[model samples]
Target: MQYELAPMEGITGYIYRNAYVKYFGGMDRYYTPFIASTGLNHKELNDVLPEHNAAFMLGEEENAGSGETPPPRLVPQILTNRAEDFLAIADRLRQMGYSHVNLNLGCPSGTVASRGRGAGFLGVPRQLDAFLEEIYKKCPLSVSVKTRIGVADMEDWEELLGIYGKYPVEEVIIHPRIQRDFYKQPIRWEGVELALQQWERTGSGIPICYNGEIHSLAEYQALRQRFPQIRRVMLGRGVLKNPFLVKQLGQWENRLQATGDAGDENVREPETNEDNRGKQSSEYCGIGGYRESEAGTAREQRRKVLWAFHQELLDGYRKIMSGDQNALFKMKELWAYFGESFPGKEKALKKIRKAVSMAQYEAAVREVFYSKS
Candidate 1:
């Protein structure tokens, strides 16, 4: 199964992607936050800079290095309603060495949707069709789309999927929620099933990737069981909540492969018993039973990895931003998701969130890690 790191507006920037790869790498693709179409400004250019997007190479040796995995593939995502602007941006990205670009039609922010951008474009099927037609004709690089089911009504997905089928896009990422639902409501799996059915019936040959509330390996396994043909999936908040999620899922697949259980279907059925759902893999189990020592060591390693990632983010932000406030702002946004990994640390996270200076922020980070460890 292919796993993608979903683009998050204020969170999944180049710095975060690099840090995540350097620490706990498993995601197959990492998407940059949406670069809105305002021509090509300095800020936008900085986001897709080839130097910043390249995989992080480890070790000092010229040819030989530790057996660490390479960084995930990076895909630049752009947000634009106008075909002309999209083609321009695509040309720029292609010139910068990106072979593929993703069009953002899934963002549900009111300001964006109000401007007839993002998910709002879903409200106008004819305009969307025209936009795709022009871009597909003129774009130099491969294009993919990320979209919600519709603007307001779930019924609108039928027409929307048909419009998507009309284009030769790389892939269509379905989030299974309408613009009005945002992230609050339970994901409309019915809508997702409908999309799969429609895509299959149309024989579009364009792959469909599901994205929504998948937080654990068991959830992913269940999703695979429900839709065995799905070969790709995108994770946003869940990955941020648990940095080890992708790694764990990948390891699970590897174990299955070793046992010859991973066949053409690509996933084995998970144990259905609720008690076994949360159990650790047998590879980590001790002779007597659960390996507390091994589990403890792994947890400690993860803590150190998270600390290293935090320091990298802090250092990277300091190098780019001009002041403590700017660095503090970015760090706080990160802690919003990073803090989820550490439960019962409300006070520590609150300190990090309320920090007004770099010194305070550094101290709070140390406190959070130290307390957790």
Candidate 2:
């Protein structure tokens, strides 16, 4: 099983990816948040600079001052309803060493949807088909799309899926919800499962990756049982709640390979000396090493991951923003997702959100993660 981290705009940037890689080390691919298209020539849209940092930030950099080969596996993502803009962005990303691009046709925000982009494009199949045709004609990299089922209703997906079947996209990532429902509703799995079968029958051969609401190992296992043939899965919110999930999957695979349990494998929690599990066992099942105890190893692991996450936010803030205003804006966005994991987290995050300066933000962060209380 392969895992890709979902691109949550403003939340999943270079620093976030870097921290994820350093601490989790299991994601097969990481995607950048969508870069909005701008400029008349679209050349600026094509210029990969700090804007391109998302694609190159993974892996190790030596000689602090030198530029060398990039280490992380990254795919550039773009959000544009216009084929010309998509092509421009793709061409530029390829020159910067990215061979894959994902179209953001699933974002549900009103401001984005109002422009006939993101989930809004799902409502118009002909326009999407036309735009894709133009993109295929000019793009230099493999193209994939991340999308929801429909703009406002599940009924709209049939025609939308038909349009997708005609294209040679590398992969189709389905979040399994209609646009109007936002991320709060249950995933429309029946629709997604049916589409997967249809896509395979047509011999599209392009892989299908499931996304959305994958909150725990049980959910992942159920999906695995339902679609045993699927080779790729994506995690968005689940990863934020428990960063160890992907690594656990990776460790399971490693254990399988080592034991030669190639088929009908039992995924029992592997027994190990308390010390070798690293971040996975320590943070996942909460302290007692997966044993049935509240203050066990799993809790310890969760605390460790959370601490690392907070420090990275500080590091990323310092690198990207010079003033408290910009840094605080970015930190608040992250707290929205990560705050759910810690005790008294909502109040801790609220304090950070209202902070007016770097000093205030630091005080709040220290209170939440570093205070003895």
RMSD of 2: 7.0
TM-score of 1: 0.86
TM-scores for all predictions? 0.86, 0.79
Give the Cα error of residue 161 in candidate 2, in Å.
Answer: 2.0
List runs of model 1 lying over 4 Å from the truth. Answer: 56-71, 260-294
Error of 2 at 14 (Å): 1.2
Residue-level lDDT of model 1, residues 1-373, one tens digit each, is 8888999977888888888888877787778899986576776688788888667321122334667555556788989899888888888787777878899999999999999999999999889999999999888788889999888888778998899898888888999889999988888888988988887787879988889988667787778789888889999987777777787678667877688564423222222222233445333221111122355665566667777878898899889889879989988987786676654445677899888988898888877766632
Candidate 1 all-Cα RMSD: 6.4
Residue 54 deviation, candidate 2, in Å? 9.1
Candidate 2 per-residue lDDT over residues 116-177, each given as its tens digit: 99998888888999998888767877788998999878887877788888778889998888
Tell me how far the alpha carbon of residue 369 in candidate 2 is from the true structure, in angstroms, after superposition: 3.0
